[model samples]
Target: MPRIIVAEIDSAEQRAVAVDVWRAANAARRRTATEARIRRIQEKLDTAELALLAHYGPRPAGMLVAETYHVDGVPLPGYGHLSMVFVDPAVWGSHVGTEMIRDLQSRGWEGLSVWTRTDNRRAQRLYERTGFTDTSNRSTLRDGEEIMQLAWSLSET
Candidate 1:
């Protein structure tokens, strides 16, 4: 079993471990534009309202970031945003990501939302299995990539 720890965003050590986990988790998908992706991840980590790090014994294996702000033009009340969730590929099927989501849900979130790359069907399936539904809301990144927003209501859990 992995140990889940709330990240100390201001701590350099935790931030470094989180970045390493993020890189390993997204290694396959981030085939190019490495520097840009690293920068984006760093920015997200720095600004996340909450962050969690999962460790398998002594090794960092996963990370999650939550933000409470509403997306531009989208009105969400009592909803928290799941800004990022990444588990090392080596532990892809170990349920770490699911556990993280469950942990978040247990915190009494009225609703939670996440944005995933439009082409990331695997992530979509995982979210759906965890009770999230497509909100049909789309957003484009500065790099012109499209993403879809998914939401889960605690009342339905």
Candidate 2:
């Protein structure tokens, strides 16, 4: 069985694991896993309200980042923004992502919101299956990738 651990986001070991998982999961769609990019991710993790790393025995398998504040341009209250969730491609169909979201929901958030690339249908399906609904709002990242916002009401859980 896999277990989740509260990550010390600023630690070198955790950061390296995060960057490795991210690169392995999204290398095709993202730029090379440069140190600068990993540093930026560490910065975000430092400010996040919650950061978790999932492990299957001794191997890192996934990560989740969440914040109490709403996502940019979103006006919702009592909602936690799920800033990031990434699972190793080797475990893509192993319920790792679902476990991460459930862990977040168990944190007492009234609701959860996330922004995902519009072209990432697999991620969309996963979120939808986990009870997130499309808010129909869209935004463009600095890299010009279009993103859609989705929200889940924890009250219904």
Candidate 3:
């Protein structure tokens, strides 16, 4: 059976995993993000308007980051821009990602959004399964690579 827990990333148990996620994301993208970059990300996490972790048992399996902001000049509810939902990759297809999303949804998030590279079909599918719909919008990463933007809304039904 799969287990999922939602807790603040500031928790002692989650600190290392948060940094690990940054490393994994950078490595997966083939970017040479240095220790400095990792520290900078940790700093942001420390002050992260909102940060949450998705845990499997006693392990920090994944995380979510929400900047808490407005879009298109319109005020909205809590907007969680999902980031670094990385599974250890050693255990791919183990439903870790799905469990993570479920945990996040249970947090009562409403106007959530996420972005994935056009070529990252795996991630796109995961987001879709979690009720995120592609907006057909595109943007470039900080490194100049093209990425497709996707969004999700918690239905009132």
Q: In angstroms, how far off is 52's CA in candidate 1?
A: 0.7
* Candidate 1 residue pairs that clash: none
Q: Please give, for residues 1-157, the per-residue lDDT of candidate 3 as tens digits.
A: 5666667776654766777865765676677888787887777677776677666677656666666546787746666677546665544566667777766677777767777888888788888887888898998988887898777777731
Q: Candidate 2, clashing residue pairs?
A: none
RMSD of 1: 2.7
Model 2 regions lying over 4 Å from their true place = 1-12, 28-30, 71-77
Better of 1 and 3 by lDDT: 1
All predictions: root-mean-square deviation over Cα? 2.7, 2.9, 2.6
| Model 1 lDDT per residue over 13-41, tens place | 78778888888867767656378878998
Candidate 2, residues 8-46, lDDT tens digits: the string is 365658866876777778774665777887778877766
lDDT of each: 0.79, 0.79, 0.71
For candidate 2, what is the lDDT?
A: 0.79
TM-score: the better of candidates 1 and 2 = 2
How many clashes in each structure? 0, 0, 0
Per-residue lDDT of 33 in model 3 = 81
Worst 10 residues of 3 by lDDT: 83-92
User: What is candidate 2's CA lDDT for residue 66?
Assistant: 85
- Candidate 2 is scored at a TM of 0.83
Total residue pair clashes for candidate 3 = 0
Clashing pairs in 3: none
